[model samples]
Target: MNFSFLSPVANAVLSHNELLSMQALGRKLRIHSVEEGIPDLTGVSVALIGVLENRNSVDYIGEEYDLNEVRKAFYALYPGSWNVTIADLGDIEKGESVEDTYFALKTTVSILIEKKIIPIIIGGSQDLTYPIYRAYDNVMPMVNIVNVDAKFDLGDSAKPIKNNSFIGKIILDEPYNLFNYAAIGYQTYFNSQEEIDLMERLYFEAYRLGEVSNDITIVEPVMRDANIVSVDLGVLKASEVSLKQRLSPNGLDGKEICAVSRYAGISNKVSAFGIFDYKPSYDDEMTEMLLAQMIWYFIEGFNYRVKDDDFVTGNNHQKYITLAESHELVFYKSIKTGRWWIEIPFLANVNNKLKKHTLLPCTHKDYLDACNNQIPDRWYKAFQKNSVY
Candidate 1:
């Protein structure tokens, strides 16, 4: 478990931690400090790493920043009744080249996932997600990403990867591990019509900002089915964040964004989680506090996770079959957690990507829609993608 790429947490934050209450989160964390180096990770469930590379941002102007404010705000909070152990693994300093930074991030995230430790990344730009996604190349057969963002970020893959266009690289790059990508809280106005049509043509999922803000629970099933969850702070409404960090006036509020993070945390399949595009400011207290709370909710949800995916037990779930149009919709409801999943039948031929029958997480509304002879959009897209791949 060599973490040579990591730089220790600043001494100032460590000094500040000593003045806090003994019950504060700062006292509870296994921190990487200048004196002790990286902390022992034994029995640690979650590791936090900050990336200080923003050179790839489309609007880069050679600015430098740090995550100390976020750390200080997070550390001062009191932890909930949680049994999970967390370690702050410090930050990955900007490398000589953006590619070098990406390599560092990819290696770090890969190592964390190999040890079954979820890495909660706080980054300068969302493009860091590309390296994180690449980290899963040999770890999983297929990957699903859920981005809590305002834009589709499907920039031209033919061009150099930037924060706004990294997804294009993910889709066109080697190994081709990306199975499904979903954008939650996307504002149509922020994305071009071509990008919206591209999302449809590729069978990827995109939920509008208004739709998600009206009902945040709609994101649970999407998050449940995801392997990587990347969040853009720009998804927050302008009033909810600092002036420098604000992007849109009509975006997710603090409560809604925090709820989304919790949903991502509660997902059994989600292994990597990241929050990106944080812009430091003189009056960043509000943004820092909100970011801290968002991380707290994620940990809180992680603590409450339940393993209810085993449908073979038969006794733990109830199966229902309904005929909608020409499709036979199979639904499974977990008795333990009351969660629902819709089965995606495996296509007989044509090089199936899933290789076997798979279950797609769905909401109760999907089941009711099937009963009324309507196909769930999620099921339809998944079925179409599975058939094609």
Candidate 2:
């Protein structure tokens, strides 16, 4: 209830009451206004926060941006059959400096996480993800990040932070809370050969845009293991969005993007979700509606969340073991949902930060591959990362 760092939404954005006649989501939203102060979040499940700081956006340069239009679009949507409480805490106006804004975000999000509320962020630039990640410092020691974007955004950390290069800062900064970073739908051309090599050398995961476009479901396992998911609007094909600055000719379509959002919501481990790099459009209904639907699907998925992280009881899951050449691979499948996970053995005498969780979410194909005497790349990479701890 003490959201001291936030500013309430402007009355103009909620002035339109036409949505009331249609049973839309606008009616159900506990919107922050000048009269009511902050919404009581006692039992709120999801809280929406808008970051109006774009000074770090590498593409926006010196221009100013706003999320009022996107807010209007999102608030006009119809809520599906869901029981989860949602509130819009309004925008975080740009601070005197970019770092000032980061501090505000870090404090606000950290408090919400302590209250067990998932924060969905709409941002001025993708760089806001850094603060969102930082907010988890006191909540959890280490976390896995899944980015749905076209570029690696690993710009040189030696220089000041920009939206495109903030990841470099995250990976090298102190406290080193990042356990794993995964990039989904990265365009090879956008990333240099050296960056690709760096991904391999660091044991991080990156799936090319083509791979996921062909089979969108491949993203399920990756998202399932993530604690934070950051999405850049620039990853959408130019046809789907109206960003004049960066016109990506090819990327994930609206449907694929929504499915990705749903997968992030379905993951029990995912605590924070953000959509960034939104270019202020004049009157683009397509882009607005698409973003609204994405939010809708995420909430729908959250409403259907199941308790499946427990693997010791052996009551709701079936376990399978396979020998690839030298090491033994163990897999678990949920009897209720048919979802799969593979176990990565912990190193002896090593204290890992991954407390009480060693089973990595995987696919049925990984089990089939193990049965054929092949080592699943996911298991191998995870094992290698864990060994370093």
> Each prediction's Cα lDDT score?
0.93, 0.86
lDDT value for candidate 2? 0.86
- Candidate 1 deviant stretches above 4 angstroms: none
Model 2, 266-286: lDDT tens digits are 888888999888777676777
lDDT per residue for candidate 1 within 1-389, as digits (tens), equals: 77999999999899999999999999999999999988999999999999999998977887878999999999999999999999999999999998999999999999999999999999999999999999999898899999999999998989999999999999999999999999999999999999999999999999999899788899999999999999999899999988898788899999999899999999998999999999877568999999999999899889999999987678999999999998999999999999999999887786756874389999999999999999999999999998789
Model 2: ten consecutive residues of lowest lDDT: 16-25
Tell me, by lDDT, which candidate is best. 1
TM-score (all chains, Cα) for each model: 0.99, 0.97
